[model samples]
Target: MSSPETFDIVVAQLGDNWTLTPVVFENEDYQLPDTPAPFVSVEIYGDFFDQASIGAGERDDNLWREGGEIFLHVMTPNGTGSRQARQYAKQLVNLFRGQDIDGVRFLDASIGAGDPGRSFSNYYAMTATIGFERDE
Candidate 1:
């Protein structure tokens, strides 16, 4: 089974980049203020596996890929127009697309507005799903 630590590393790195908005992580406790505002929710999915081979014999040349995805939930106030959501989505794409971090290669992200699977029930949302892989 793949350990979530791989994705958590990405999460940790994002801490230094949260100046735009407050970031809420999955399974963490947070105290939302009385006023509703824009925020981002991060979710991670890690998939690490061992490939079975015939007669490779643990060769150093043998390569395996460990892949994962990070989901960015850009949540904004419902009363506001979609502009704020789109702006956040753009920044998220710019941050993750074609980037290499700690050996993880992040690919072009797929984005969608008003995602049906929003992390926050009360906010209008745009979701950015980034697929990343690392050579192991």
Candidate 2:
């Protein structure tokens, strides 16, 4: 069998706020440096998806199994980089939340390029995936 994927799982119960478990996922790309902008993308990603907590299940080969994906792009003034591309990707996931018929998880976040000189233009993109358990 393939190796299992370990992720930083966050769970939101029936009424309480979401909780971030201490268990660290095998993937550490999601952890970002403490930036001045504070990488508000995290907040945006979560709020955009209305996700209260992280997923609570294993991932399949599909894009998402239970959790969703959020993309964040930091663009330059010239608008020439992977920043916008990445943001667009996250937007794609946000556009289609709670609509999956298969009930799979899709927490795949990717980043693009950044403008080396621009202020915030130092573009960067981020995606957050949320996976949930399959119901009987």
Candidate 3:
């Protein structure tokens, strides 16, 4: 598999930490459960940057700085308080706060305070965006 595909799988595995909600990964033909339940949506974004050169004659083309964020959207019932969702976010934080998975060194995680606007009448949602980087 290519690097992006490998990264995608690595990020998807982090969603496994959320056992309370079903996970929906990107690139899959999927829809949230119809019964108004909690669920997780996962997407991966990455890029490679050129490394600064310090030598007069060296192969700099091979040096690359790669990184990305694992964007996870956790959805829960709107009427219910966000305690469960926040707890889930905490679980995610614990999973990736400062760890490396498949060469992706996770730097930190950001949990959305709360987003009622992202919710419909029946479900409220929050986001946990985990940032990671690697140099190769």
Per-residue accuracy of model 2 over 3-117 as CA lDDT, tens digit each: 1221122212101321211112223255443432223232222211232344546433223222223333232223455455445445434533443324433433333323232
Model 2 global lDDT (CA atoms, 0 to 1): 0.32
Segments in model 3 whose C-alpha atoms lie over 4 Å from true places? 1-12, 15-18, 52-61, 113-117
Question: Residue by residue across 63-100, what tens digits does model 3's lDDT show?
Answer: 56666777777788878788887788778767877876
Better of 1 and 2 by TM-score: 1
Residue ranges of candidate 2 with Cα displaced over 4 Å: 1-83, 105-125
Model 1 TM-score is 0.80
Model 1, position 122, has a per-residue lDDT of 62
**Candidate 2 backbone overlaps, count:** 16
Worst 10 residues of 3 by lDDT: 1-10
Predicted model with the maximum lDDT: 1
**Model 3 residue 35 distance off true place after TM-score fit, in angstroms:** 1.7
On TM-score, the leading prediction is 1
TM-score for each predicted model, relative to the true structure: 0.80, 0.24, 0.77
lDDT of each: 0.74, 0.32, 0.70
For model 1, state the Cα shift of residue 103 in Å.
0.6
List ranges where model 1 is wrong by over 4 Å: 1-5, 50-55, 59-62, 113-121
Tell me the deviation in Å of residue 130 in model 1: 0.8
> What lDDT tens digits, residue by residue, belong to model 1 across residues 1-136?
2346566667666776657898888787877667778888888776664543436666645676777778888888777777788788788778778988777788858778335534355677778888887776
